[model samples]
Target chain A: MSERLLTVSSSPHARGKQTTKSIMTDVIIALLPATAVGFYVFGLKAVILVVTGIATCVLTELCCEKIMHRDVTIGDMSAALTGLLLALNVPVNCPWWVLMIGCVFAIVMVKQIFGGLGCNFANPALAARVLLVASWPSHMTGKAFIPVDAVVSATPLAIIKEGGDAIPSALQMFLGFDGVYGCIGEISAAALILGFIYLLYKKVISWRIPVTYVATVAVLSFCFGLSAYEVLIQVLAGGLMLGAIFMATDYVTSPATAKAQFIYAFGCGLMTVLIRQKGGYPEGVSFSILFMNFVTPLLDKYLRITKYGEVKK
Target chain B: MEIKKGTFKKGIHPSYNKHYTSSLPIEIMPSPKEVAIPMSMHTGAPATPVVEVGQYVHLGELIGQAAGYISANIHASVSGTVKAIEPRLMGNGSKVSCVVIENDFQDAPCENVEKYDPETVSPEDIVKIIQNAGIVGEGGATFPTSVKLSPGPDAKIDYVIINGAECEPYLTSDHALMREQAAKVAGGLHLAMKVFGLDKGYIGIEDNKPDAIEAFKALNDDSIIVYELETKYPQGSEKHLISAIAGREVPSGGLPAQAGCIVINAGTAAAIYDAVTEGKPLYERVVTVTGSGIKQPKVLLFRIGTNVNEIIEYCGGLTDDIAKVILGGPMMGPAVYDPNVPAGKGTSGILCLNRADAHIEDPSNCIRCAKCTEVCPMGLMPMYLGAFSQKRNFEKCDEYNALDCIECGCCAFTCPARRPLVAEIRVAKRGVQALRKKRG
Candidate 1:
């Protein structure tokens, strides 16, 4: 017994089974339904875009870590999750090179340059989508949506922005617009809800952010004098479910406490409604989430919960 | 009287690996041939050695005298001749002066040992007897129980709570004690309530231990109320247990007396009863020798100063792949490299973990997931405390109330990034203390 080597450390020799790799794996598993829906709606091009996005993001992460002399962390599956979220954020017909550019920008500029993984101040996928929309408007926006019949058309949000009655019905928006088009993941609200349920069930994310975000949108939209049908369409339409469930709830970019999370998500919902109603952009999810990501550190610093047994004055 | 069930908020439920020894009967191990009793087993000043080398001492004989008002007396666990008085390794990895003795196996009792009738003794005399017996909180804090019993005159302590929660994973000494010696535990509680001049006493047991609960409930003592607490890690924590049973929060930086409560461990209660009724000193305790690395898991009542190596050898020795040997429960127990370290007053369990269970992963950067904040029983944000401590920004750590942290390891255990949140916060707490000292 005296000859045997033993490890000595401080208290807590045991650890919980969850790891960064496992959490990333859970998020990846949760996104499968939306990815499958995207593939079914937009055919092989969606698959190609997703594959390209993942490969480029993963390769870029490897190169960046090597160049920075940091440990290779691609095994954590974070870069792959970002790649998948990026693919879902863009149109299915997005040029392969354009999707690749978005993927590299996400992994390199938004994630690795500021340090890595937890150090990134912005959601990589959302920031890259914003950059792409600004740089290549034609490739990213107008006539970018292609329905199954190969007809190029405006998305439901775009139709709503144009004050056109051709907007799809609420039910069509809830399922997917059969005759209309949107971003690959935003095409089906049902698929996004399925993914959200899986995430909640797996304890990957909490309900405070997503539930508060969507409810804020619905409540504020009605307060803005929109009809109940229009409010339902607004709740189920373009990127709202996807962004609220996936993007805004990103752990690295969101607030840390439940109170701060409610306030941050409320800010996102309020900004999204304001931008969609009055700002220059027709869609608001990406911009609102990215803007609120910058405020997360402040919210966390100020909105700390009262410590147990604190003596209140 | 109806039994009440209660719980505090925001504690994690780690897998309680109590099945190995929870059902096993407490077996008394034969006293070892030699023992090395440390003078610093209890918190506060170390006891002063009163015996020299070669002095013959009987069992229950006072070998070391309490040096200060806060220290505890040390007694000989076995009748033996003193071999040496030197520094020896202890379970906490520190070397303290020890009274090494070679047991003669004479089983002779000390002439000074005397018993008293509980009905005839005053509460203050009982407290004095407890102090003379060197009894401390046996749930591992080892704080001198006499200090708790004699609170400041201004303190208005109204509750006497016995902690039977035993919330730590893989340790069942308390459970076995409660199941096997329920009457002594109840008698101890009655004695404690008499000291406080209180009518009601409470025992807080986690709902997971229905057998221990049944044992206590079977007593049918009207003065003692058994509360079934939610089975959560750290439910045995003094502050949390007070919050759950007494419905009071110990003020930050204050003792349980500030909350009108006096919380003692179940083992400590039993020891108190023995000290008063049979004139026994606290020279031995029940320690659970368990975990995946041990060949056999058991609850053993052994001499206090016996080396962990002998205890493990009695438990059929370690398995072939044993990697870490913790001196207590996994959560708060210190991992010791030397198996020769003697069990002290606070050693509750000897947990031998295998290679797979002892593997520590390389921690990644914090993702700001806030899972640590969510599960922190103290309600302090551990993520920022860890970050600021890493950055060496003690001012930020102080501003964040890092001093309020209980070092429960809840944050570290639940972190997905495997960040050593508790370890970092401990550093921050020290830093904050130094900063306050400098300001003063």
Candidate 2:
């Protein structure tokens, strides 16, 4: 007689080694290099903001899961990532209340409210950033983005808005040594680029959106009469790198088709330029990405990769 | 005429497990003791078995009868004695009535097995011959070839596109066949052209298969356009290939014939060649038995009804702890619980993956990464379909174009979040299909 040694599911019988925990774990690991760089660039303040954001996000998520009577998904670290991203988007000196509110928006409103992680129709952190920007424009503006040993001033977009003559040096802007003060994530171009490179190396993100987004912005900005250097500075400065690499490239919130993604990124660029040149906001990466995120699904519907062997009249 | 190069789309390059068996040549397995011929191996109506139990059958003799316009006849692969008539697992895991025969080793005489002159045959004769030959698309879709060949007069088929674009990973059966049987494939194309009365025929092969391209080029039939396709997942898809090579955009929700074109798989073409030329019926097909977990990956010329387990055993058995026993290529194949499934006309690849290799994480919430959208070949929103299906909202599934999904696994493969997209979307498809049936 065959002994019943162990109860096991039969073939397919097996799940791939890639689980939610593993994917979330990989994402956290990929985000670490950038987190460390942010900490280094902004000192202990950056760490505090990140810790606060993570705490609130995790707390909000746990609370929501409990109320929803769903299994606690804190183990997935998705909440942690959302918190980290939200924290990264704000000013390093942002009050704990601001971080908490952003965390609530990202975790409770953007992510969990829509059914968590992949189900959330938009990138939680990006949405939260946009929400925070819209709700508290003064706080979200370039008020505290000063670099270590640099004079605090306006961002290039802000400077252009006030007067193009008042803009910071191209080198300073490129190196994130701008005289302006801004959000927690916007001050360090080098740090964000480094983070972007790390994420690329980790394969956490593909280069398509970031490459196309920055290229489109620079090309369009140049074609629209902005000096080539200003275009480069604009591309390198502010939240363009942050939004392009971290926020705009959010897999779920972006357009699905390649052509659609290209258009989405281009749309983001166009919106950013319009807001900078004519609209009220000096920098529009946050709004542009969030707006584009809303249209991603529709874009995907209209633009799709043809099914193999799928022919039509 | 136009050779498309590499592509940049939302596609995944999963381990090209093709590296394992792609270099291997096609080998004929010794004839099996018994063969099971299923009538419903193709996409449409199940064929009706003509022979009774205990009846003797010769190689190439029709054992099953086509029931409708979409069905194809099933022929005996070997001279055998009908052992049993019962339900058996055909490729795609569907249980259908199959005629089981025990090989008699006599190789009994078959009827009308001869090569035909494509140039001399009239289009009507070609159609009748194709119908009699029981040839169907053998590219795993198993669509009846004659019905596709019989283009309506209003929808004049101007071009015959031979799909050599075996875009699925790890399945090199088409590649191996194209490399080895170029003449047979081309002859099948000629037969297709004659039947359709179409002038131009293009063989679309992916640029990745250099050897296969060279082989077709050497065949040098001026009428056959050996166009190299860009290396992309689903480039072999009928619409994408037509758009890529023929420069004709299939109108949304339209058929290829509506665009004055007819597409046939390279394997299907070879079967057509055999059918008209040798008067042989489609009883056996080439299958690529491959995966990282298998000990030896190879393209075997397997007879229908040969058990998958027997083939696996012949292939040196499992290399790792088996995770999945899929009946076809991973992208579109259905997972099977039992390895006793008999190979059929549509059984292109049998992927045996081990635990570490085949594992996918429990699906989490959709991040709305749109990876599903980016990689979706049908351009349908898989996320909405999956989300709505999870809620059992079949109506919303319809609204999301769940019917448009080809179930190509690209959404699941490229998803950063390990979502069971294809599995969920399939539920939605079934739901919609059921509702449509209810309404009808």
Candidate 3:
């Protein structure tokens, strides 16, 4: 006679039709469109940044797990996503050292130190970007964004922050025509939008965080100084799309409840506007996501999803 | 056109993957030469064996009698000789006393014990007939139907909720039963409603099953209203269904009857109809034999105590790379190593998954995304419960409502980092539940 077994132990069953590998594979495919755009805009530098970021992120994860006596999880491909996201957040002109620091911070400090993957309270890439931004403001803000033709220019946010009247045109920003001089990663709006499209098509990221966060930032930024159309440009330009589609929507760090996610996205947009309008920083997607990440657990606690059969309060 | 209103706040839509065999009608599985009927199929007290070794018994003969009001009887699935009454393996890695019957193939007949005349039977008599027939909830929760149908001294049920939702993917036994045995289900519903003196019945089906909804709607009786629920995991859960149709909240730590409702599965209703109309006990049920790894997928009308391996072989055998052999639907079913355990009353589906489908990586720490909380039908914090479970803090796990988790698998399904949220939480739930019973 054979033995009976515990069936409902938890997910995932060893024999489920879907697996973590399949999901991660789907995510990688989704991220490819955006990475290709980065290559088109920044050429070889974008490829170097992505490769270096991935290597550093993976190595750091392995080292941390080794030190903690935990099994190596390089197979999960989460560290690779973190690396890719970190690279996307950094400037195209960011030095190798800056990218390495961001990778270490993202993989070890933000992810592994706080309990890897699902345990971390905030998105690793966003936290690392925020930290890198704070530690080396000059490198982060002073670097020139170079386009395909080697044309260098300041980002629209930088132009606005510097009190320059000649801000880049909405069409130029939409097409990523000029921001190439400010930072490497922020160069092409077209490339980032491609990534957004890929994610939307693959359903790797839902529309809630990106749509809500952008709308919130657009309305609030317009309320400050930029024209409504200019605010729209700001919403679409810079790291707003990158942060919304990838970082802010990090399943682990984001609020799980729909009500809470709506609030979390709004908070992300509000903070982005707050930082852009009044804070020392010229752009704010990274800091905005990090700040909102801190409140995600609390938001989840109070903003419980109304369950089936639960009496509404 | 207006969008259909959903009952719950948040849910994940997993790949249906039902096309493998959704259109197939249920086939009847041949009764095994010998049957092993487990005594503890239901949740409450396990029945005690009333028959001894070497005794002859006919099909539907009572083998195990209910030990309590919350328990149900066990019957012989085939006309056979009682070989032995001993501990046998159950689907969930547990062991229970099971009566082994060796079939004679002659199908030796026994004298008619007793039959409840449905036309002359009173409400109480119907309840007695149900109790005697050994009917239990067939929607994976094998709670005794008689007790659920019995309203308390002050309790009055205004609604008989027929659970046709079958929210768990890949399990279509209920769906098949609804489509094929609508008359029988309706008859059982009548019996249940008559007993409760309820005037109205609501059949909750996930919007995914438009055909099942249409089938019931075509039978349009004023008493039965078919409500199309949004296609969401755990939509068929009792509390979720109660909220969906009746707009009633079964208070935390309370039963559904507290809010004037008693939930019953569509399969259970059909079984009840069989018992009252045909004087048959609950010895057989429609079990969905499916999964991507199986050679052929089928919904087989299988008798209780038939070996699972035999049933799978009947369905064209497990494919070469079978990894998991689950006893129910993928969402909440348990994995079983043994293929010898017989299908019990609650066994509705047997899912055979291939190696590619079965590989699960180790879970990472909680990312605190709170997705688990959003999708939880019970409104419990799965992340915290999982954390507490990891910490072995059973008390905290209980406080977080770990027991309330129906193990719907929604949290795990939506977790991007692929954290084993429900797996860890279930451990804590079991730990806490054991402690509670110990304290009591």
Q: Report lDDT (CA) for all predictions.
A: 0.91, 0.76, 0.78
Q: What order do you get sorting by DockQ, best first?
A: 1, 3, 2
lDDT string, candidate 1, A215-307, tens digits: 999999999999998899889987999999999999999999999999999999999999988888789999999999999999988999888
TM-score for each prediction? Answer: 0.99, 0.83, 0.86
Model 2, docking class: acceptable
Which tens-of-lDDT digit does each residue in B153-220 have in candidate 3?
89978889889888877888888888887877877888888887776777788887777777777776
**Residue lDDT tens for model 2, A205-285:** 677888888988898888889888778778876688878888888877887667888999988888888877678877888
By TM-score, is 1 or 2 better? 1
DockQ of each candidate relative to the true complex: 0.82, 0.26, 0.32
Report fnat, model 3.
0.38
The order by descending lDDT is: 1, 3, 2
TM-score of chain B of each: 0.99, 0.95, 0.95
**B1-440, model 2: which lDDT tens digit per residue?**
33344332345455556787788899998778887777778878899999999898998788888998988888888898999999986545468898999998786868656667766777787777778878888777778888988767788777898899888877899999999999999888888887766666888888889999889888767777788877777777777777767677566667788887889999989988887767777878899988866888889998877878788888988664666677777677777766776788888888877777676555566666565665676666677787899998998898777877766677777655666777788789899989889989
What TM-score should be assigned to candidate 1? 0.99
Clashing pairs in 1: none
